[model samples]
Structures are given as structure tokens and as C-alpha cells.
Target: MDQGQLVRILLSLILVVGMILAAAWAARRGGLLRQSQTRRIRILDSQRLGARATLALVQVDDREILIGVTPQQISLLHAGAAPRDDDDFRSHLDQARSS
Candidate 1:
């Protein structure tokens, strides 16, 4: 291709990339792809066990649970009520943050 044609191709590529970035920014800014408001369950912590396995601490409503997960199955390891005291919950949160 000629030098003029090469310049046009490069400009087009740059414009395309800039447009994609702008679109992504706009979507995020407008909260078009934000997390669901109705989603109740949240993962408090997670650790990888193997290539396709993980252990996760999940919080649902006022309950906390530890679950073992694999590609083929998910198993509940433990379940307990969340701490009711503010001080205890804060300490637990601090411990989790430190880890």
C-alpha cells in the first residue's frame, strides 16, 4: 500500500481503540453494568484449592457458611449464624482484612 493509505489505516485503528475505551468508560460511569441490587449472597472470602477447586466463605442474609467447591460438585463444610455484636463483627472483619 502507499504511504497515504498506510497512514489512513493507522488512524482508523487508533480511532477504533479510542472509541472502545470511551464506550467502556461511559457504561461504567452510567452504571449500566453495575452489580444487581437484588443480589443477596456475597462471597466473604475465597481460596483456591487446585486447578479447578476452591473453598469459599459466603454470607447469605444473617448466616455465614464455608463451602468446598469443585468443578463437579459443591459441598457445604460448615454453617453458622453471623456475629450479632458490633464489636465482634468488627473484630472478625479486621481479622479477615489482615489475612
Candidate 2:
């Protein structure tokens, strides 16, 4: 095979791998969001769900939760969080940040 063809093949493989990884990551996040959303709805109900306009930072057991609510609805969602402990939290964060 020519050098150009070999390089093209390699680049194509890399691109494909990158795309696969991206899609997998996205799917993972979507799954997590659905699970959390489902849990909130089941446990808390729409009445407890907060509005997007009113949001407050609520921390619990190391994990930070963003509680947003309006007069009609309430929801407990994730915004951004820091590690709880140096060991367990770090490992969890590493896995999350990886895949």
C-alpha cells in the first residue's frame, strides 16, 4: 500500500474511534440524567419540583445538588460538584471524567 493510503487509513481509524467515544459518553450522560430525573419524579413528584427561574445550591453527603423550584414545580438536578473525599471521591471523579 502507498504511504498516503496508509496514513489515510490510520486517520480514518482515529476519527472513527473518536466519534465512537463521543457517542458513548453522550449516551452515558443521557442515561444518568434520565435515571435521576425519573427518580426525582417518582419520589418527589411534580409538586416538589422546582422551577428553572428559582435555583439554590443544595449540598448533601459530599455530592452537591442544585435545587430549582417554582411555585408549581420542584426538581433536584446536578449542576457542578466537587469531590467529597480525597480517596473515594477522586476515584469516582476519575471514572466519571474518563468514560
Candidate 3:
């Protein structure tokens, strides 16, 4: 192909790439691609057991779950009520001292 045809192709490719990047930027700015502010499930901690295995502590609402994860599947090791915040412990201590 001629120099003129090569330049046209390069410009078209650049324009298409720029349009895609701009669309992604616009979606992020408009919050269309953002995760929700209020998430019910959260990963509290995680530990790698081996090459393909992982132990994860997850909090879902008021429950704390211990899960074992591997390439094949995820299994629940244990599930219990979530621990109370440090503030709750402090408050209880203060009440006991006053009583």
C-alpha cells in the first residue's frame, strides 16, 4: 500500500482506541462501572494454603464464615456470629466498673 493509505489506517486505529478509552472513562466517572457502596459480603482475611488452596474468612451481614477455596470448589469450614467491635467491649468494661 502507499504511504497515504498506511497513514489513514493508523489514524483510524488510533481514533477507535481513543473512543474505547473515553467510553470507559465516562462510564467510571458516571459510576456505571463502580461497585456498590453498601456491600453485604466482605473478605475479612485470607491465607494461601498451597499452590491451589486458600483459606478465607468472610463476613456476610452478621455472620462470620471460614471457607476453604481451591481450583475445584469452595467449602465452608465453619460459620458463626461475627465478633463485636472493640467499642462494644470498651463500653461493657466501663459499665462494669461503674456498677
* Alpha-carbon RMSD, candidate 1: 9.2
| Candidate 3 lDDT tens digits, 8-82 | 999999999999999999999999999996899999999999999999999998799999999999999999967
Segments of candidate 2 deviating more than 4 angstroms: 32-99
Best by TM-score: 3
Weakest 10 consecutive residues of candidate 1 by summed lDDT: 81-90
RMSD values for the candidates in order, in angstroms, are: 9.2, 17.7, 3.8
Candidate 2, residue 74: how far the Cα is off, in Å: 43
For all predicted structures, in order, the TM-scores are: 0.60, 0.33, 0.64
Give the candidate order by descending lDDT: 3, 1, 2
- lDDT of prediction 2: 0.67
lDDT of 2 by residue, 1-99 (tens): 999999999999999999999988998988843555323222222233233356666655445667767776767767456666679978989999999
Instruction: Predict model 1's lDDT versus the native.
Output: 0.93
Give the better candidate number (1 or 3) by TM-score.
3
Q: How does model 1 score by TM-score?
A: 0.60
Which candidate leads in lDDT?
Answer: 3
Model 1, 35-82: lDDT tens digits are 986668999999998999999999897789999999889999999966
